[model samples]
Target: MNPRLLLAIYLAITLAPLGLSAFSGRPARSLWDELASGAGMLAYAIILAEFLLSGRFRSISRRIGMDVTMRFHQLFARSALVFALLHPFLYRAPSKPPYPWDTTRQLTLTDDLSAIASGVAAWLLLTPLVLQAIGRDRLDMRYEVWRLMHGLGAAAVAALLLHHTLAAGRYSADPVLAAVWIGLFAIALASLLSIYLVKPVLKRMRPWVVDSVRPVAARTWEVTLAPRGHGGLRYLAGQFAWLNIGHGPASLFENPFSISSAPAAGNRVAFIIKELGDFTRTVGRIRPGTPAYLDAPHGHLCVAGRDEPGIALIAGGVGIAPLLGILRQLRLDRDPRPTLLAYGNRVAEQIVCRDEIDDLARHHGTRVIHALQEPPPGWTGHSGMLDAAFFRDHLADPGMREWLFVICGPPAMMDAAETALIGLGVPARQIICERFRYD
Candidate 1:
């Protein structure tokens, strides 16, 4: 599941169709016509690859990190859009009746109305699909609704494009290439089925029940759950899970949340979620023992096997969820590493588990530093945003580069910290960061 291996596989699958088309032994066509076909073929392959890159697969997302996987998905989608948009326009010739002497009809494009209709339909459908994904956050629809629509739209577009390719494509007339397209489409379907169907069915066999939901901070609640029959989740610290509280295993009503409690805390897993969405705003209303489902142990932000002598845990607002799990695990293991926690919130009330974080500092030797943008009167712990200045002033020790710096926060703060870390001569590999923004 190495990132390089996944990338190599991606390039091979995407380019193989183009290679096969080029060597399909078809009669020579105009360069522009060949280029047009190449664009369409490449675009289609990339479009199909997007399903695997959707972060539903642990091999892709966990290996490369969810943020990187998602970013690649977005980029590949746009690339496919560009190629698809120009696919038809790049052609130089129109369909014409083959001359009596011409056997291959290389001068004419496919004039099949059925094939053309499918292509047109795919083209029309893909435009809004890409646009909707780009503007997903701006839309007012529920996340689950958007997710379902995106999946269905993608499937329709893929199906239409497949028909158009097999029917209209010069190289796709070859049996081998046609089968390759079918195989790629099948893989896409299998990936979706694995995520949507297989995983859900497995989660249903070992369901969970909510233990409690209590307000821990401003607009934030600590929701805990216990496995109904199975031994609790065995995930590493700093990982996350998709929790479906009171929702069926097959339902798309789950949301991803980082595990806030340590693995040593046993099967009773906990999550610190804020009121960011419609489902989360009602976290406090869920009664005890509500049936829940978990598709969990995702993410790669943990430090279980690290060789660092120290740990720097920096978080912003609710981004502290995963980092708390890391810190708590370190405490439970009686780890001797020097630890520093820099937690920031807009106001004092937004600080989650303040007493517990402070207790980790006293009992486990973790230096818990809290930063408030709007600190109360005569507050002394650091103020304003966790900008580059804060990182430079606080984490500038020479030996700091040897420590693992785990950071999760708003995009701006994470960016600033990354820049500051590089400026401080810390290698990028020494830093672990997860962005809280889903979009």
Candidate 2:
């Protein structure tokens, strides 16, 4: 069966109750209404599960073959905000006039003051989530800030949601639905606690030692790590690992870095780090053998099971890290499939792993095309940014869309390349891209 078909079936099973309720012509106390309400709770539970289960989320997103995970995250957050707004209005009865201390004594689900406080908290959380999703770039908020805010917002929403669930008493009136809601909340809480608390504690106990830091360029550094005992995680090529240098084992300061070295190279793992933030900028400052922790081997950028006749890699800056790993894997595996690399850099000097790329091209019969914005006086390679004209000139058979195109780069470059390909009549399914933003 098609993976998408299975996903549709799963969604129907989880949300059919709500659909059934919409068609029922009965009061709130009727069985159909109760079933619909229960199904609504179940749908929310599924959303919560999606946020908690990292493995399942990754698998499903990869299977769907789109950036559905991120889209779902945005959708779930927006829906939660809407629910937060509706929960207060629906659950709380209108204020009753009473001769209290002041003008009009407003009655609430909980005490009026407590209800107001929780509502304010929920608003504070939901507002930022909506703003961040809509205007993330305009806010100039750093990736770390965004991540921290997302976590805080999720916690606040969960707390307010729990308060509403308990105070309303309608959903809780149904024992099974209440139990399912509680179970879902418990799982979300536990998963978050494990990631934030337990994981760091474990890392403090078993920290990997940083062996060396080598400069690949002025802005890029390769940090090597050796596990204290059994070594860090064993990962395939084209995978990424999060590195926490100065923080404790469970610290959220970790940043994802692609494994620059191939897995076949041995026990030590190396990450090619670009100076993108405070954590990455200080990477070169840490002395060799300093204790560190890694959470790794994530991402689905591998070509393990792919059977394409040819592969084309388009990379910009540090986005080349995963492509490098893929190339190294191909070299080690001795695969003779034709490959082409179109690497873009600001200047000739900023081109990373140039020698290694050239060597791979020579050995594996791959073609390397260097596209630079500013080539030096003596430079002879292609100049200017990669655009439609560039692809039109270099790519063979302008109409054929069968070849796989793997793109990884800065947002603008990736957008340009994607636009160029689509303008040339390339099918959307034929183009695969990986956005490398940390958040």
Candidate 3:
């Protein structure tokens, strides 16, 4: 079945109970109500699971089908807070006075205590999410600081949510609902604990030795790692792995980087690191043979299942990292489908993997179009940004729409390329892009 259709079906199944509630005249009492409540709990649990398991915000956002996952997270979290607040008010029992006014007064008076605690927790979680969404550029918190705050705030919310759930156990009275809620909590806790504790313990027990580190460019370096004794992870092209360059997992500094090599080659992996900030700037200086731990082979950006007759890759800056992996995989797989790459860089000197790209064009029948924003005096390649005119001129058959356009770039560049492709009559389904922005 089509993945989108399957997702739709799954969502419908998960939300069917809530949909039926609007039509039901009586208050929730039957098995159907229990089922609906159970499903809702399960959905919330799934959301938490997806968030905690993700290595980065971008990955979580994509998993949840949003351009910015944090925005959706804030919206959903606030909505959950509202639902949680109203839950008791709508279902509380009457007081001894037996008067409706008395019951209302009693609920209003006591609800604030539980509501305030959960509200505070929800606000703590929502504040960072909203700030990150709106002030990503302005709030210059270090990555480590931001990560610590995010994790701690999430834990606070989870603990408060647990308290709220247990305090009002009506929802948990139904075994199915209780089980789903507890199961979700357990999964999220276990996933986080595994990442924070178990994985680190194992890494300490067995670690990989960094074989060598070679400077590739002014600020970029290529780090080659080999498993100490056991073979390393088996990964596909366009997939990323998390790296921790320390003795124990307690270091609290782990980042995801794409594997710049073909997957067919085993036991060793190469990561092309560019020093954009503090974490990466020190990468090259790490001593050779230092112990490193990697948790890897993640990401859905690959051309393995794509059967399009032609492929067009649009890349900008370091976004070309994954595309390099894809190209290498295509070569290793011996797939000769016509591939066109429109790689854009600010200047000629910044064009990464220039030699490899040119070599691919020469040997694999691929065509590479280099778009330089500011060409030097002696430059002869295409100049200016990639727009509608560029696509109209270079694409072999613009009207065919049989080509798969794979775009990876800065958010603005990706948006522009997508719009230009759409304006040129490419169907939405035929265009594929990856968003790597974390904030």
Q: Which candidate is the best by TM-score?
A: 1
**Residue by residue across 9-127, what tens digits does model 2's lDDT show?**
54664464344434444335434434433533543544455454332234454454324455555665566556544444444234433336532222312355664566456556666
Q: Which regions of candidate 1 fall more than 4 Å away from where they truly are?
A: 97-103, 436-439
Tens digits of per-residue lDDT for model 3 on 103-189? 323222234467447634654564455456446457777776777776666666665665555444334434555455566567667
TM-score against native, each model: 0.98, 0.81, 0.78
Q: Model 1: how far is 368 from its true place, Å? A: 1.3
- Report the Cα lDDT for candidate 1: 0.90
Order the candidates by TM-score, highest first. 1, 2, 3
Pairs of residues clashing in candidate 3 = none
Every candidate's lDDT: 0.90, 0.67, 0.65
Assess the local accuracy of residue 81 in candidate 1 as a C-alpha lDDT between 0 and 100. Answer: 97
Error of 2 at 22 (Å): 7.3
Give residue 423's lDDT in candidate 1 (0 to 100): 92
User: Local error of candidate 1 at 264, Å?
Assistant: 1.9
